[model samples]
Structure formats: structure tokens, C-alpha cells
Target chain A: DVKVTQSSRYLVKRTGEKVFLECVQDMDHENMFWYRQDPGLGLRLIYFSYDVKMKEKGDIPEGYSVSREKKERFSLILESASTNQTSMYLCASGVGQGIVLTKNIQYFGAGTRLSVL
Target chain B: AQRVTQPEKLLSVFKGAPVELKCNYSYSGSPELFWYVQYSRQRLQLLLRHISRESIKGFTADLNKGETSFHLKKPFAQEEDSAMYYCALKDRGGKLIFGQGTELSVKP
Candidate 1:
């Protein structure tokens, strides 16, 4: 079974603080995604990395950025955390470029609930 | 326009009652749809996908191309089934666009 691990489960930070949320996958999948889960709005993509040092902006990526220095780890960075950024953040990884059907199957991590106060 | 739409914000039912969660999408070509569920304090996970054509935990969803809908159905609801359900569509770019979600609450 694939395992995706997020560094933190709950975090609290003051406004304008820099926050980092880390995610690591054991399966060495080529694709990694970051999303913020909100009530009534569901999961909105924030950023995704298909390879080391390569990143793509998702639907909502203005205040957030991501890092993929290594194949197994992806990190989400908030340049300046705001109260509105408080939400559950999820990390997922999927098989890369082999079988189209399996590539869409993403294994997820326990979300990090960040509270920007 | 939203790529995926799950009209209901919440659905409540009693145990043993049937349940249906509606999902619709707008796309021009072939579409790949999936249902995902997140239980309380648990990570979100995939429930089933359209191509699989297999029932999961007594839940089944049929993709209707004519209607552009893939609704999840379960013959009987259980307390363990209560969760936030999301319908997602795999776009041409390979990214998954998810619906707003439907919170299913099965009462005892």
C-alpha cells in the first residue's frame, strides 16, 4: 500500500507569518498535489509537482507556493499567512505516466489543519 | 463555469434507507469520473471510479453520458457510511476537478 505522510496535523500561526507544510510519499510517485479543503467549496487545487523542481499552479495558488527538492518530498509554503488561509490542506501522490487509469488514482495523506490567526 | 457540480450541500437519511448523491459535469470529450469519501478525522480516499464498473461497500455509480451525470447510489445506508462525498472528473490535462461535495449523515 502507498503511504503519504504530512508533517503536521494541526498548526496555528499569527498573521503575516511564514508557514511550511511538508508531505512525503513512500511510493516515489512522480506526481504530487496540494489542495485546500473547505466547507461547501470542496477541495481546490493549490499547486502540483510532476517532477523534482517542476511545479504547476492550480486553480488557487496566489498566496501559496510549493517546493519539490526531492522526489519523495513536497512542501507547501505560505509566504505570508493570513486568517483566510486557515483551512485543511491535503497532499496526494499518483502514479506517473504509465497507465492512464492508475495515474488518476491518488493516494492521500492525513490533512494538515492550519489555523492562521 | 464549474467543471463539476454536486448540488446538495448535505443529505440526511436513516439507517437502511437508500441514498443517492448527485454529480454532474461539463465536458466535450470522454470523461473519467470518480467518487471520493472523507470520514470524520480521516484522510480523503477514493471510493470508486467510473471505469471500474464495480460496486464498493454496497455503493455504485453509473456514468450517464447523455445526462453528463454520475450519481452514487447505495441500497442501504449505514452509520459508518456517513461522510463527506466528493465527485471528481479527470480533465484532459490529467488533473482532477472536484465537486463542492455532499455531506451524508446517516442517523440511527
Candidate 2:
């Protein structure tokens, strides 16, 4: 079984504060992703990392950055958290060679619900 | 650009009734489609994929290229089957573009 762990289940931050959401996977997957879930909007990708130090922007990457200094860990950074940023964040990891997207099977963490006040 | 569309945001059915959740996509090339489910307090997991052509948890979906739809169906709606279902499309780069998702509620 694959295990994807998010560092927090519930988080709270003030406006204009910096926030970090951490994720770790035990499956040694090569691809990691961060997504935000909102009502009626589904899961929107924030950022993704294919390899260490390699990152790509997803559909909703504004005001957010990601770090992948190691294979097992991926971190999402909110530069200046705002009330609008309050939402459920999810992290997923997939085992793929990074060449073909269809071959990748992603496993997701439990998710972190963040509240920005 | 690849896109996924799940028209229904919510669906309700009585137990032992048939249920269907509609999903459509707009992709220029051949696309890979997937269905994912998230139970209460559980992480999102893959329910099934078009390539595999398998039924999972009594739920099955068929890809219709003509209509560009992949609708999930089940003969009987079980209370345990109630969950948030998402339809996703795999882009050329392996990134998944997801639909807005549909919440299924099976009334006993």
C-alpha cells in the first residue's frame, strides 16, 4: 500500500502570513502535486514537481510556490495567505517515468483544510 | 487544451435503484479517462480507468468517444457507495485535469 502523509489536517493562519503545507510519500514516486479543492470547482492543481528541483505550474499557481528538495517530500508555500486562500489542500504522488502521463497512477493524501483569517 | 466536464454537482438515488453520473471531455487527441472516488474522511483514490475496462465496487463506466462522455453507472445504489466522484483526463504530459465532481447520495 502507498502512504501519502500531509503534515496537518487543520491549519489556521492570519492574513498576510506565510503558510507552509508539507507532504511526504513512502512510495518513492517521481511526481508530486499540490491541489486546492473548492465547492463546485473540483480539484485545481497548484503546482507539481517531476523531480527534485524541477517544478511546473498548474492551472492555479498564483500566490503559491512549491519545493521539492527531496524525493519523498513536497512542500507548498503560500507567500501571503489571504481569506480567499482558505480551502482544502491535497497532495498526491505518482510513480511514473515522467514521459507518459497515462501510465501514472496517483495516490493522494488525506488533505489539509486551511483557514485564513 | 484538454478539459473534463462533469455536469451534475449532486445526484441522489434510492437504494436498489440505478444510478448514473455523467462526464464529458473536450480533448483534441486520444484521451485517457479515469474515475476517482473520495469517501468521507478518506483520501481520494482511483475507482477505475477506461484502459482497464473493469468494474470496481459494482460501479462501471464506459468511454463514448462519439459523445466524448464517460458516465459512471451502477445497477444498485448502496449506501456505502455514496461519495464524491471525480472524472479526470490525462494530458499529454501525464497531468490530470479534473472535472468539478459529483456528490452521490444513496438513500436507504
Name the weakest run of 10 consecutive residues (lDDT summed) in model 1 chain A.
Answer: A95-104
Q: Candidate 1's residue-wise lDDT over B1-108, tens digit each?
A: 439999999999999999999999998888999999999988899999999998999999999999999999999999999999999999777889999999999999
Task: Give candidate 2's iRMS in Å, 1 decimal.
Answer: 1.4
The Cα error of candidate 1 at residue B43, in Å, is 0.8
Per-residue CA lDDT of model 1 for A32-82, tens digit only, reads: 999999999999999998889999999999999999999999999999999
Candidate 1: interface RMSD equals: 2.4
Displacement of residue A35 (Cα, Å) in model 2 is: 0.3
TM-score (chain A only) for the predictions, listed in order:
0.95, 0.96
TM per model? Answer: 0.97, 0.98
Model 2 agreement with the true structure over B1-108: per-residue lDDT tens digits: 689999999999999999999999999878899999999889999999999999999999999999999999999999999999999999877789999999999999
